[model samples]
Structure formats: structure tokens, C-alpha cells
Target: MRSFSRLNSMQTKLTLTFLLILLPLVSVSIFANYYSQSIMNEQISDRTKGALLTTLEYIDQLTQNMDQQTLLIASNPNIVDIWKGIENPLSPDHLYGIHTVQQQLTALTNVNGAVKDAFIIHGESGNGVSTLKGGIKWPDVKKDYWFQQTIKGSGGLVVYVPTRESRNPSLYMSEDMIYYMRLLDVLSSTREPNVMVLAVDKRSFQKIIQNLQTSINMNITLLYNDGFVLETNPNSENLHKEEPFSITVKKGEWSMRLEQPREEVFKLSHILQQFTYLITAISIMLAIWIAWLVYSSISKPLQQLSGAFKQFSSGNLAFEVVHQRKDEFGFVMNGFNRMAAAQRKMIEDDYEKELRLAKAEFSLLQSQINPHFLYNTLDSIYSVASSNRIPEISEMVINLARFFRVSLGKGRDSFTLAETVQHLMYYMRVQQIRKDHFTEEIELDEATKELQILKLLLQPIVENSIIHGLEQSPNEGYLCIRSRIVEDRLYVEVEDTGVGIPEDRLQEIIMEMDKITSKSYMSSPDKPTSLYYGLKNVKSRVKLYYGGDADLLIDSQEGKGTKVTLILPMGKEGHT
Candidate 1:
């Protein structure tokens, strides 16, 4: 499974794709190398064979001319008659015949350049007449192996490589000379016939082989009757070591063999093969490089994009794919970055709007409470004064004046815990005048008193305790407002002993506040009723002003009491 997954990776896929494209080209290159080598081998063989045949033809022509010359010398009427008459070559009577035969042999040798000498031997007397050694006696001729063989054989024209002993000493004969012999029976009745022998220099044949060798760059070997004759290249031992291309041509008793080294013959093919291999290697490297480039260009960006998407889905709006390319991947990455930025901006804008709306709602609630509370307080003061000049009326008026003065706070949105607590005491004092059944207790930690808090943050909770918690109770109620610092946070609690809230009503109030916390307070078409409306307002104000770091929690029990705690983080100012 791991291997298969790796194969599916971008780098692997790119490599495989490059290989797929390269496969056919590499195959063609290899096949062409093989095919070209085969063609070169065949061409070399055919061409070399043609050259060998040409050399053979030249050699055959020389031998054929020599043979014709030998035949002509033996069949001459004078030579034939002289041979028939030459029973004793020491006699003066036949000296003329022998001399005449010598003249003919001389002419025969002179007529052909390849034939260095010619001889006519009398088979019966074992004597011969040579162009070089004229009037040879029977004993002198009989001592020659050529003469002995010619006399013993029944033959027509035959070529021989002469032994050193068989060469005529009188003539300057070379070892490279060949002899062509023809037995003549001009006297048909006599079985003892004469012979005509022509000594041919092999230099002419060597010249022909050398010319062919030079033109074709090959080694040429001439064979006469399967015997070593001459070779154009003497250092052909290396040619035999390795397989070589060879061609043989035969003409009569002579055969020509042409040899060329296989490497030399297919040199072009070998070069092509090497060139193809080099090109293949370079192409493979280039393919890998291109695959790597593609992987870098495509795969890396895709992975970035994939990761960005995951982060975005997980609510990380700041995650962005970074790329510098101007290709498609770059375009996609840029789009992704724009999308994340746009989404982040949208969320921030929505949050800002929610904050503004909540602020406006809090201000409106504060505005409504100030005027209406002043009217009620003034009326209550009127009632207290009209009924009696009570000390309570004086206290209510002073507290109401102080409450209004502190609630205004010179347009400040927040105040120190001490100032906010002092404001709360003034409001509770006014409430105490209205409802004497409740008594208030205020305890503040010095640490908390100096901490800054949102204005009107505690007032609504104390009002709720007085109006809803303490006002309904027939007996005496207690109200406690306390502030403390705990865990780097400011905690202010308002506790009351009164009728308290039923469990179901408390749950309803909490659910309503939760709804406002979860969504924008102004999202609802209708405003909250008077029931826990001040608490809802405080909840919304706290959420908007302090965000999640501040909260309002309510605890209540039937006929027991109610408590509302405001939690605010230290060292953080509430949002206006």
C-alpha cells in the first residue's frame, strides 16, 4: 500500500510520465543501432566480396594469359617438331632444333610481363629448353623437381609454387615466382609428350591485391590450390583474433580472401550506438529534471493549498498559501489568500457592527432608565415631602442627585471599581428610600476598588435585586454588593434575600440572555420585556464591552434569594 501510494505521488507520476514518453524514443534508438549495425555488416561483407572478386579476376587474367602463352609455346610447330626429334640433345644434328625451341620460349617469356621465364622440356629425353638457360641438357633438367613432376604427370595447364631447388640457377628467379606448366602431345601417336612451363612473377598479383586493399581498407590473401600464395597485409594476425568480416572468391586454382575487422567495418554503427546511449542518458537526466521541476511547480503549491484549506475550514482565517510563481498554482494560491483575507475582513466587520449595535442598545437602555428613574424619584420625593418633611426625603434627594452625577461620569465609559461602587451605593440608597423592607451591605477589596470597570456594570444587577428579588418579599430583605479580585480577574457579586426567582423563570431568563449572547442583541425584532430586562441589558453590555473575557452569571432559588456575579478580566479595558 505504501509503495502504491508513493507511485501515486506527483514526483513519481511525473517520472513515470517522462518514462512513458521516453520509452519509444529509446526503443527506436536501440533498434536503429542494431539495425544499422546489421546493415553495415552486410554491406561490408558484400563490398569486400566484390573487391575480392575483382582481385581474383585480375589474378585469373594473369594466369590465363600465362597459360595461353605456355600453350602457344608447347603447340608451336617448330617446338613440337624439335621436341619429337630431340632424343639426344648432345648431338649436333638436333642442336638447331633445340636452339629454335629456345628462341620460341624466349619470345613467350618476353611477350608477357608477368612471365619472367619459359621452358620447354622433352619428356622422353628428360631435357628442356629454357628462355634463361638455353640448350639445357637432360641431366640438368632432370635434377629440377618441376621437370620431374611434369614428366611424371599426365596434365594440361597447372600452376605451381616452385621450390628453391627447382628454380633455374642460370636465371635470376625469385622465390615469389609461380610456374604454369602444360603437357603437350603434338605427336598424337607418342605417349611421351613434351611440357611447356612458364615462370610467372607474383609481383603483378601482389600489386592488384595491394590496390584493392588500399581502396577498401581490407586484408587480401591470395591462395593457389588452397596453399599460401601472397597477402596484402602481413600483420593480419590481429584480424584473425577477433571475428572479422570476410569474403572469398575463386578463379581456377587461385582463390582470394578479403578480411576486415568487425569493429572497423561497423565503426559507424558503433559510434551511432555510443551516441544513442549518450543521448539516452542525457535525455533520461533531462526527463528527471523536468519531472522534478514539475513536482516543484505543481505539487508543492497543491500541498500548500490543501493545508490552507484545512486551516481555513478549521476557522483559522489568517492561514494563507504563499507562492511566488506566476503559473496556475500561483493564481490559485493568490485566490486562496484573497478568499481568506476577505473572510477575515467580513468576520471582523460583522463583529464591529455587533459591537456598535450592542453599544447603541446599552446607551438607549441607559437613556431610558435615567429620565424615567429621575421622574419616578422626583415624584417619590414629592410624595415624601407633600406627606411629611421626612429625613428620608432629604436622603433620597441627595442620593438621587449623586446617582445622576455619577451615572453621567463626565461622558466616560468606564470607572474605577471604587467610583462604580460609590455610584451603586447612591442608587441603592435611593432604592432603600422607596423600599425600606430591604437593607444593603457593600464590601469591596482594596485591590478591586482600584481596578477599572465598565460604567453602569453593577447598577442593573443591584436594581434587579431591589425590584425583582427584594421588592416582592413581604418580610425584610437583605441586599449585598461585594467586589473582590480572584485569579487576576475582578469579580463583583450582588446578593439579595427576597422572594427570589422560581427555577423555571430563572432558566427562562438565562436562556434569553444566552440567546442574546450567542447572536446580536438587535437581531431580534422585539425588545425584551421588563421581566429581567435590566439583567439582559447588563449581559449584552458586558459581552459587547468586554467580549468573552467578561461575563454575567445569575443564581437564584425560590423564596431563598438571588445572586448575580459580574466577572471582568484585570488589566483589560471594556470596549466603548
Candidate 2:
């Protein structure tokens, strides 16, 4: 009995050790298998969904391409010329016109891949009068119930139909058949009159089949709009299953069946599961072994370092780290100590210097702008008062009020584009009032009227042109503000027909703006500040709002004129 008890004790110890070693491996393998299966299922589902949607998208794109081709052929200028020439089909010239129609259709078909062939159908309406009726057919084009239904349903409807019988034989194999068709009415340029039926080839259907096969590992079968199975890529074994998986296409007028094997998708998931199991097993074993060592090497040191960092962040940079070993943590602590010391010394040396520089720059900028605005405002008022122009004085006051109102838009960064334009107009009015030498015209597109623009953007550019370009010219100058939107961009051009910039100076200005360091001339406090302060302010603000895309494009010819353009961010009008 004692000997049996000893053997049992030995077996229990062996069992405990074995479990300790093998438990992680078994857990990892099971987890990996389950995860792999899940991944495979997800991939299968996604591929099936994407395949269905892509098939519909392919059909839609093909339909659009065909419609565009038909419209192009119908609206061809040559068609009208041919119609005139074909007054009498018996004439040689009239026969040449008939040939021209075929030539035009052929040329269009070649350029538009979706178009199979284009022909002028020689058919007449209900009227007894005979007329030229023409229609084109795509390769493997089909005649299906959809075409007949559309013909009988709508008097003059342009419809997309199944292409089962409409396949163009020239493009597809003789044995392969089409399953769908798209029919459209060829219309005159006025579009009110129908000329003929324009049918596109079933090549789009072929593309849909090919793409669906590439995207999904399934036996895909497309059904016509009238619920007829048009095309199927399948194996013989699965062709006549009594009960098949049917997937309804919610996005399009079609049906699908993914009866293909899903083993590959599941196989990928299995591979991932195996990898994850291996990682998890390794992690669990390492975690147990490292838990104890981590307390001394990583966890304790990390706790000490964290406390030191917190102290340092709270302005106690003099705090010391107590780690002794020469490892990563020791090196980090040493670096932190050095950084803290350097930061302390640098702060002392640079704090006053930075503050002084900032204050001086601020004062200089303020002094420059303060007197400039004062001069413009005072000059406008003085002129109005001197001329006894009460209405002009009132206008000047209103403009001044509006300018300040925009300058402080509740301290917000942006204002409505209309407000920007309004303020810019007031500034221009003030400049015109003060100088009375430059004539300006402002035009804005209706679409871009409500877009938001940075405040004081155009005013400075306009001011710069008026000051540097117009002021230098002896004769009257012209300034125009024109704006338009191309695609998604808003382009505002401020052009002046004054003394244009010299080539050398223009190149220098470009370099200066590019580097953002044209402050040498701006350093002088006694010189005129309009060109410097206004330009610098506008440039800085533009950079703040839109980093690099926002810019100034200057085009000029000395003695002709200078145009300062602001390219800025574009947004929809009244969009929050």
C-alpha cells in the first residue's frame, strides 16, 4: 500500500508539470482554429457582398457610357450635314450621305468602348410620311422581353433592357450568348423629338461576369430584368441543384447565386488563427516568467521614472532618479537630468530676449497699421468735409464702421465671404475716395457669394496694388476684382492697369514671399507702410488659415499693370 501511494504521488507531480507546459499550446491551437474560421467567414461574406454590388456598379457605368455615346452620335454636326445632303436617296450624293451615317456611327463606336455599333435606323413615326430610321447594335446584342416590354410600354422611353439576344457576334465567341440589353431612343438636338432606337452591345454584361468572378469565389449567375437567367459561370456538377443558394441584388435589377466553394477564404482565416495561437501561447508563457523579473527590472524602474517625470513636469526639474544599473532606464534618466539642466539655463538666457523681440515686432506692426488706417480714414473724412460732401461723409463713416466690424467678427477666425467682399468694397471705396485717381471694378460669381473667406484678405492686396502700382503711375489706372470657381476651387483675381512690376523686381518679390522673410524693407519705421504691413499681414493670415495651398500669384509687366491674386480655400455657400 505504501509503495502504491508513492507511485501515485510521482504521477500527480508529472501530470502537473505536463499541464503547465502543454496548456498554453493547446489553448493557442484551439483559439487559432476558431479565429481562422471566423476570419474566413467574414472574408466570404464581404467578398459575396462586394461582388454583388460591383456587378450592379459595372452595369450602371456601362449604361452611362453607352448613353453618352448614343447622344454623341445623334448630336453629331455631321449628322445634320448628312441629313441635308440626303434629300434624295437615289442621288449619288444622297447615297454618299447614307455611307457617311455609317461612317460616323463606326467612328463613335470605336472611341466609346461600351458602344458596339451605331447605325441610322430608317423608320417613320405614326405619320404615313417615310423618313430615315436608324439604330446601332453592340456585339452579342440580344432581343429580349425587356426590349419588347419597353417598346410596348412607353411611347418614346429610353430604357435599359436585358442583353441575352443582343450580343454582338463580332465581339463575343460564336457559342457564347448575351443575357441583357439596353435600349435608348436617339433624339434630335432639341431632345423633344425621337429619331430612332439606340441599342448598346452586351459587352457590359461580359465585363460584369468577368469582374464578379475575380471578386468572389462563387458560381455567379446574372438574371435579366424580366427574371430570366441570362448568363452563368458554373461547373457541371452544380448546374442543376434542386435547392440552390439565391442572393438577391438589392442595389440593382438582378439576382445572384454564390454556389462556389468557400474553402479558400476559410483557409486564409485558419492561417491567421494559427499565427495568433502561436503568439498567444508564447505571450502567456513569457508573461508568467517575466511577471517576477518585471517587478525589479521594468515595473519598479518605470514607477520611479514616472514619478520623476511628474515632478519634473510640475517644475521640480531638480528631482533625481535612483536607478543604478546601466540599462535603458538608466540612460533615459541620465538624459532627462541633462535636459532638465539645459532647460533651466536656456530659459534664463532666452526668456527676456524672446519677449523683447516679440514686443518690438508687435509694436512695429501695430505702429505701421495704426497710422496707415488713421491716414486713410482721416484723409477720406477730410476730403468729404472739405468738399462739403455730406453724403460722401456719411458713406465714409458707414464704410469705416463696416471695416471695423469685419476686423472684429466676434473675435472669430473666419467671416462670410459676403462680409469679406463688403468690407473689401468699403476699403476700396475709401481708397478711391482718398486718391480719386484709380478706377476699380468688382465682379463676383453668384455661386461663390456665400463662401467663407479670411477677413482683410482682399483689402490688403487691393491696397498693395493701389499703393505700389497705381500710385507710381502718372496717368489714371484701372483695377478690377474678378472671381470664379473652377471645379472645387475659388480663384479671385485682382488686376490693375497701372505701372506694372519690373521683371527683376517681380522675381525678387516671388522669392521673398516664398521664403516669408521680406521684412528688411519693413524694418524702417519712417517709410510708407501700406505695401509692407498690408502684404505681410495678409500673407501671415493666409498661411494661418491654409498652410501652403493658400498663396499670392503676382503677374505684371512694367508700365502696363500689376495683378495681385489671392488663391484661397473654397467652401460651399452658407455651409456650416
Q: Name the top lDDT candidate.
A: 1
Per-residue C-alpha lDDT of model 2 across residues 432-452, encoded as one tens digit per residue: 777788887878888867777
**What lDDT score is found at residue 464 in candidate 1?**
75
What is candidate 1's lDDT per residue for 236-270, written digit by digit as tens? Answer: 56687687777788887789887777777777778
Candidate 2's TM-score = 0.37
lDDT of 1 at 469: 77
Model 2 spans > 4 angstroms off? 1-338, 341-345, 348-352, 372-420, 433-460, 467-493, 511-553, 565-576
Error of 1 at 530 (Å): 99
